[model samples]
Target chain A: MNCLLCNCQLSMRLCITELFLPIDHQRETVCDACRARFSAYHLSKQCCPGCGHPLNGELLCSECQAWKNNYGQFLHHRPLFHYNEAMAEYMSLYKFQGLYQLRMVFQHVVQMAIKQEEYDLLVPIPVSPTTLRTRGFNQVEGFLEGMQFHQLLTTIDDHKARQSARTRQERLVSQQPFQLNNNVRVTGQHILLVDDVYTTGRTLYHAADLLWQAGCQRVKTLSLAR
Target chain B: MQKTDFYGRRVLLNAEEAQQIRIPNLEIMPAVKKNGDRIYCYRCGQTSSCDTSHLPNNQYYCPVCFNLGRSSSLACYGHLAEPNHFTLPTSILTWSGQLSPLQKRVSQAIDQGMTNHQRQLLWAVTGAGKTEMIFAGIAHALARRERIAIASPRVDVCLELFPRLQAAFANTPIALLHGRTPEPYQYRQLTICTTHQLLRFYHAFDNLIVDEVDSFPYAANQALLFATNNAVKKTGGILFMTATPGRTLEQQIHRHQLHVHYLPLRYHGHLLPQIKINLAPRWRKNMERGLLPLTLIRSIKATLSAQHQCLLFIPHIDDLPLVEQVLYRQLTNSRFTTVYAADPQRIEKVQAMRDGDYDFLITTSILERGVTFPEIDVYVLGADDSVFSSSALVQIAGRAGRAVTRPTGRVIFWVSALSRSVNDARRQISLMNRKGRCLQRELSSL
Candidate 1:
């Protein structure tokens, strides 16, 4: 099999290892050289307690500290990689370019990270209707391709600008854009909010607030990039 | 009173809004197909089915052309109005350069073809001043208040032609469109763009001229052919100019689908440089053993010592590093560089060679055409390889002896075994030279 990202011939042994082992996060769609280019976040690195951005051994980064000060309810977040140049290019191709084949490049690693977590339900942050109409596929749902996830939270406003388009301060102070689905029950359940990138923690916080209002006991967050 | 830019200029939307402004200009052509909820676009012609969306009713979006601002079923092509104003200069052809008698003859035929609105093929040999011959025809079209577009298969050709066209038509506003170029799309009397950019235009030009029509990704490609056909208006004309016409174009000529015109002589009145073959058996094995073939090494030394630049062409990009290392050891006293298609320093290395900073440049076929270096000899390491087509071999030989001062240069092909492509290239060059000699004799008698 050839890697989908680079079209390089993939090793049969590596494919077999990926098929048999869960911890072996090697992907058939990604070549070894391209995989090495991604700056994956390590648990051993000094990171912020809230957003998971790499830090200098501080308990919390200043941005996370500001978030904690503004809102007492901080969602516990885990990120798989730092927002390096390679990750930025990956997002540009997968999200902006609508090259859905690149979703396979980060599938295995993100799935493995999600498997290590403990949560009753996984809910991906919903995209605006305009994004779905234009981009054809939800990028966060693309990362969680085969894995099971619930669409409990629906975007409330179709005309609201995307969180990525807003400044960090604007995003932090923006009104809620998520509304819990009345038919689905999130009450008294541990919910994990997933996204492709955690830019300012505002999008996840908005989703978490709606779940809290729906009587969810706990809320955590997971993203492919920070 | 609000104004919005449509093509390149701003116009008031009026009270009827943008919809009324877009309606009268657009008439849906056979370029759109509907199957159930999906629609296929004939413009970018790359996909069978576009993704359907649930906005403004069920709309279909061509995902392939999303980068070019979403060519979809919801969008209508801009209807270009006929030019009612003729802002012709006193002398439209501002070029101070000279064209040979043969070039002038073909140039007049092309101008006549544009006026008659017919398809004509200008089969000129390389170094025949093809671009210079088109200036008169373009000037004629501009004076008639006709929109003109010059499309090529390669971006390098478009980039090279843009500035030359701009300089020739100083009074006319020209737009250059290519994927990598930073120039924005605009409505001009003259437009020069790559063939891929032709998909964005609909019934846009009154006269379309396609250069390098047989080059890669354009020859025998249906999508590009569709774009070329659809880009012109119903009554518009097309002029195809190429050095090496591919098999499809030749078949078309045989079937009388296109009218043929020929200019067999170069601008300097010299014949194309013929290719000479030398057998280099197992040259790759010799390189691995740290020894170079005596015949190939001698060829490189002769050209370098003669104070002429040498362009050593390799068959594949994978062989570049090994060949560069072998040549570095063999030609110890020469300064040379290796370049390939994906090399980041490709442009800089080529400029360095043009500036006479390098004695020799070992390159792949990427520099076979659209590049000219004065008094340079050409060599192909493996002319028998499958990677080297007959047309490519002709173009490679055409690279040599391009300058007016040095009208002749050596073209050597070092092959392990004689291939049909190699023999065909030699025969094509000899055939063109014969035709050129016949033309010269006819001119002398007249």
Candidate 2:
């Protein structure tokens, strides 16, 4: 089967993207694509196992994640696929198009794009109840349909963008960030942050920023489509 | 928005979601109220807004969500590449345009694999013209805008292959990547590279081919296999072309587990080239004192009379120059060139021979691999050369008969001593020839 995530074949075990599919390639278990996309991809290695970064071999953005103690851990929120016009169109029918059945494909491609990683938990990015009622579901939550689920952390606070409108330079200058639920704590745990479409990557950046602040060992992001 | 205009295919999910995503199929996450904090778990429908909650360490769903599970199985290279992109073509090597048994079987396998998008392995023998068989599949994938990469061990082989493939599909954007070439800047659909160069790519091409699959660099290193996997695009086609498949591959093929092709003969009604052993051990060792090896000296003169350029392979650089000097001395006015390691003039010398600058060329193992001349009589002084690998010797001999005049040559191996390698080379040549003839007969019958 074509993994919606990494687009790798679905032969063996279920990759992270497999959870969204109805029938996998082998027609036995899930596939590797989904597992890779949703698994704790960021925590797979010590960031030291290889001379290069541990997050993703393709994006060797983190050369020093191991030595640095804590500065909002991710090297850079560099999403794998290009969220171009074509991808955006796929997302329109996929993200906002209300074709919920398409979530399985998202999982497949994402899984194909990424591979297996070691992480503490797969945390679906949380949304507000009011927002969920209007949208009918948390975008990422829909991907976890057939996946094993968890209740690790809550999305208690709605983070704000640093500024309303600004040039690229201005936005880079403003730098306001996401705030998580302080009542709950997630310290020194590998965090695989699941989301839907990776548009600006700012939202995932803000969310992961909150995660690292809580002392999480690592934070990674995966979306149905990018 | 796909510029060329692709219809929006609203792709659907398969069974993976039910198995790997979440078994029970609850796409909606329930909000819960925990100590005044609102949280949710998509699996159990438990949220901070709900009354019940589970501990963080409690085993509820699979590990990915909780980040506490295994891959469930070891993922192989076939899974990383697209299965549907592989299509072995029925070879049209000679003008008759008939697919050999090996070509037919391999093409069927690749076609099947590409259509199903599944991983597969294809095994065959040397001189099988395995490259020609995959051209149809590769061309198809390229037409579809899918990416492809054909990789092998030696650059010389790439030198021979690239031109042939380029001719097959005119005016396509093809890239031959190595340390010298720049990486594709926004546009490189099909590529060729040495395995060492593969480490530079990561999930890029849609179809991956490891030519001479049993050859070094690719077979000896697990990391190379990993690198090939990394360079290929997700769900791409993977094809391995090899002659002497290792025991592991042989077992798979014997069990009918791998996709296989077996083209044993040369195209165009040509017979497998012939080999001859020159029993001149004593003559070679004692010829150092300004004396010419009678057997070699005679063969060279007779070969010249036949209007054939001769390739005399001596094991050492010292002997190559010595042979050139001796041949010059023996024939008085005859012209000859020597090509060996560190011969800064190697290319000039090779070109000189090609341009017919000299009637003979004495070379080292450098010419033992690629670069074929149609009608060359080849002689190996140290056919027992440890430096001469089995594949290398076979290929050097293959350079003979490349010209239609004599679809073969007088391959004389002058050995000071007999070694296992010499026997191996002889055995290999014989077996390959027999297989080639057998296949040719079969192909003709068909």
Candidate 3:
């Protein structure tokens, strides 16, 4: 097998348990060198509880403070990795270039992270109909393969620019682009929202705000990158 | 959106650009075609078993050539027939440089091959003015209104060849294409591009000259070979120029399947420098202990004392830091730097070496080909390592004694255990030198 990212030949040695066990597990899709490029977030570090951004001994970041003032409640988001250069390159290939095979690089990590969170419904952020048509598969859904997730939200048909193209101020002031799907039960239920990346906290906030209006008891969010 | 952009090229267009292509003569086809259980990419010409590169809704994208652009079943490619729209110029050859008599002979053979549309190979030694020898052939093809392209496997070779080609074909419009080039593609009679960029072309060139055909990533890559075959017209000619032809090309020559031209001597009619092998065991262990072999250090000191630069070719990049430290400790007064493929300042470092700024350089095989440093000696510290192919070793040895003023220099290989590649490299150099000696005698008598 070869790494999905670097295309180097992989020689995976079989462990004792793997050699004896009859059950087949998913093989590694990336080499150790390529995998080492992505760094996981340090949860022990002082960070904002609202958005998980690194903080210098502060209660909340300015963006999360604004979120708390507007909605009377802020989302508690757990991000897996930092949005460093390697992560940015990974996003460009996996999302922009649409290399479907690259989803395997981080699928297991995202799955394992999602498993740690407790929620009644795992709701993945939805792509617009146009994006669904063009990009084929929803990027957030690509990371959630073989797992149970609810597509409770659907994006509104707004032909606006992509979030990545917008500046920070523009992304912060952008209006909500998501709505709850028809006839979804969310009253008094704990909801967990999933997204591929949490850039300025606007996208996840929009989805969380809709779920809050739908009378969910509590809402939490998780993303692959901050 | 110009019609000329799609002429003789298979271009992937987005939704916005696809709508603007209003040309009626253009042929449109799916970027990828799906068979029973496999999907074939039209651009790279590779078929995969639909297990890994699949998408939703029975769609698939090619993973092989995804770096150029994603070619999927959902995308379509536009190909306009090659118009060959070139205006015949009054004077196509602007190069005033003189070629040696032997070089002139090889140049005529290349011109004949291009005229007859036959596949040929030019087996020239290093520093034989191979680029100058091809000017007449390219000029002839341009005069006949036939499109020509010069491609190489390495981007460095393409970049170096582009300016020389521009100076040679002064009036002809030449386009330089590569992965990182910011300029958009244009319809030019002549083009200089890397081999990877040839995937975007379809029967585009009447004559394609591939320099350094035995170099890496193109020497044995099936997809690139397929691209070369697909990029040329059915009746077009191909001329592969290389100092060290690989086993496949050698077999082709042996079978009389390929027309061959040999320029065994250098432009100055001098023979190649022979390689001397010295066994140096535990060199890597000693390097880790901050020490170099006595023989290797003596050779470096000798070259430096003689006021000549030397290149120390290591087997791997991982050993560069250790070797650099050892060299600094041993030769404290001399100035040097180490370079590898990923070094951001590799080009600048090579330029500095050419300017006589450094006494010696520790480098990997990245500088083994397509570079020249005058009045320099060459040494391979780990010549028996698996990384040093026979061709690579020969290229490294060729780096020395290239200038006319310094027709001879030292070439040494410090090997722990002599291997077949090392032996083969030494034997090949001797054989070339023998042939070059015979050529020299004949020319002197004449």
lDDT of 2 by residue, B201-246 (tens): 5456667787876555455455566666666656666777765555
Ranking by DockQ: 3, 1, 2
What docking grade applies to model 2?
Answer: incorrect
The Cα local distance difference test for each model comes to 0.78, 0.56, 0.89
| Segments in model 2 whose C-alpha atoms lie over 4 Å from true places | A1-226, B1-110, B113-132, B142-147, B155-176, B183-189, B201-206, B212-226, B229-237, B242-258, B280-287, B290-292, B443-446
| Model 3 ranges off by over 4 Å | A13-15, A22-26, A158-160, B14-20, B35-37, B285-294, B301-308, B324-337, B342-359
RMSD of 1: 4.8
lDDT of 3 by residue, B81-191 (tens): 788988877889999998877989889999999999888999899878899999999998898889899999989899989999899888987899999999889899999
| Model 1, C-alpha of B362: deviation from truth (Å) | 1.9
Q: Give the winner by lDDT: 1 or 3.
A: 3
Per-candidate TM vs. native? Answer: 0.85, 0.47, 0.93
- Evaluated on the second chain alone, the candidates' TM-scores are 0.82, 0.65, 0.91
- What is candidate 1's lDDT per residue for B1-446, written digit by digit as tens? 11111332222221223345544443333334566666666566655443322223444555455455554444444433444344666766667888777778888988898898888898899877789988998998889888889999988788889889888988787888888867545567788989888877666678999998978878867778888887887888999998877767777889998887878778777888899999889987876787666877888898878888989998888888888888787788899999998999999999999999999998998988878898999988988998788888989999998888998999999998999889878887887789889998998899
Structure candidate 3, residue pairs in collision: none
